[model samples]
Target: MSDLYIGLMSGTSLDGVDGVLVDFSSVQPRVLSHATQGFDDRFRAELLQLNTSGPDELHRAALAANELARVYALVVKRLLETTGTQPAQVRAVGAHGQTVRHRPQQFDGTGYTLQLNQPGLLAELCGMDVVADFRSRDVAAGGQGAPLVPPFHQALFGQLPGVTAVLNIGGISNLSLLNASGAGSLIGFDCGPGNALMDAWSQTHTRQAFDAEGRWAAAGTVHAGLLQSLLSEPFLALPAPKSTGRDLFNGPWLQAHLQSFAHVSAQDVQATLTELTAQACADSLLKQAPDCKRLIVCGGGALNTHLMSRLRALLPGCDVASSAVHGLPPLQVEATAFAWLARQCLERQTGSVQSVTGARGARILGAIYPA
Candidate 1:
């Protein structure tokens, strides 16, 4: 029997899915292989539209969920083919379906989050046991069903003495701090905007999906006015146990911040947004985990060269680097995390800590769909 689990992650950016075949046969699990599968243009647009109020809500979301499963099935096929592994040999798949809405605080009750996925479809399509819906349980338990990767960071970086922080710069930025083998204070929360605002601006101006290595931002100067205004967002001051997404920091939100600075150039806005992300992350790390020695960045934002420079500039004396510096590629860490989460669920282990998500307590996350 192969103790293998595949993790499929499509982050808040509405980006493609990242699939990783993970082997937990040893003390430290290993990513046997990693592959990325893209969503078609229609599906991407559909998901983006679903982010806000739209027509035909029930029908559209259901269609999008089914489509998400189809795309995920493609990822599974690619992962198994590339690794020469059979679906039957794999244990389970941890599918963090695309998160459309992550509102952990609702007026009526604790709160809720929704990830567009069809695990039953995935299990049927991929011929493997599927584990997904990893966030709802934490929310049901009165926790912000966000920043689910911190424990994985703790497990991965736990043995490295001193305070170690893992910053995942996806659509939104989140910080996961671990003090070496659970030795000290652990903190995890969404820092602020990562690529979402920047990408939206880039797409609007350049017609490109992203700002390729943060080149545009590097070419521009950070407008202090805009940066200050952006920094003034209330989410930043709320302290830990808080999380946010594009719902609050999208393009319109950025535009609202920029309205006062009409003369600011587009590139400058990009630069300021980039600064916003770096500053929020750095400030949170310095304040929350003062003794943090090593900062490892993962997600698509880590690949942004200029963003890395900004982080290093803000965080002097802290060895700022990508997750690749440690071993796992920046893009693969989250997907691999889901794979580990699947293992946790199957073993009845708690995947989240109360301190991180403000959950009532640790609980096994994700729903299992038998093959």
Candidate 2:
């Protein structure tokens, strides 16, 4: 059998879908091809709306999921076509599906984390087996059900001589701590908000999808008062094995914080928000992995030069750089990780780490839809 797989990821930012065709026959999986398809403004808005409660949300959620599957299928087609590979030659497609709600260990004590995806539909559309719902199993095992990329991070960067960290700043920020020892020393968790707040603020004030290299924030001044208010969010102080999404850091939450600072300029708020993200991430590293010597950043936020600079400034002890310098580009890291996870599922191997998610034990994740 061929060791080819496809990985699709559309994160909390709702930016778009990223797909990768990977060949895993070798020790280091090689990314055969990569493709991205951005969501139209209308679709992006709908996905964002679906994050909160609304009338007939059950029906709306179902339709949105189907649409997401279609989008995933389109990306899969592009990956296969770009690589000139046949679907039958691929083992499986790991679809992370857009996370609409993520509140683990809440309410019922076994709180569910919902991701919008119709994997069976994706399997049918692409003629490939699909592996998805990767978080639920971990949650059921009494875990945070997030920061699933750590094991993959260990696979890619664990051999370094000291404590190394991988920070993926999507809509939410997550950190993977890898010590030189091995998997026994790995730990990972969601740090806090990443691009979600800044993206929302930019769309509201500047009518742009994002700050574009965080230029809007770069042009503004950071407001000390507003920065303090934003940092006071309780999630930022939560202990490890914690994960969060739009549920805690949405527009309403920001608006509530802003009610106390009506005089703050829009640009200053943008700068302050950028600082909030940088500070949250830096604080997490300093607190949890103070020995970390290198921080390899990945995901959409990695493209924000201003955010990158803020991180570098905050963590004066560490050498911060993009994941591109470490072999994979920022955008490709998560997708490639999912590809690796799918392979683990097929092999009946454990994917989640016990130390990272606080699960009872490591478990093979994801549900497979055979082709």
Best by lDDT: 2
Per-residue lDDT over 270-321 for candidate 1, one digit per residue giving the tens place of the 0 to 100 score? 8988999999999998888776779999999999999999999998979999
lDDT of 2 by residue, 1-371 (tens): 98999999999888999999999998888999999999999899899998989989999999999999999999999998887899999999999999999888889988989999999899899999999999999999999899899999999888777889999999999999997345448989999899999999999999999999999999999999889988998889989888999999899999999999999999999999999999999999999978778999999999999999999999998999999998899999999999999999999999999999998999999999998
Stretches > 4 Å off in candidate 2: 180-183
Candidate 2 worst ten-residue window by lDDT: 178-187
The TM-score of predicted model 1 comes to 0.98
Q: Pick the candidate with the highest TM-score.
A: 2
Report the number of clashing residue pairs per model.
1, 0
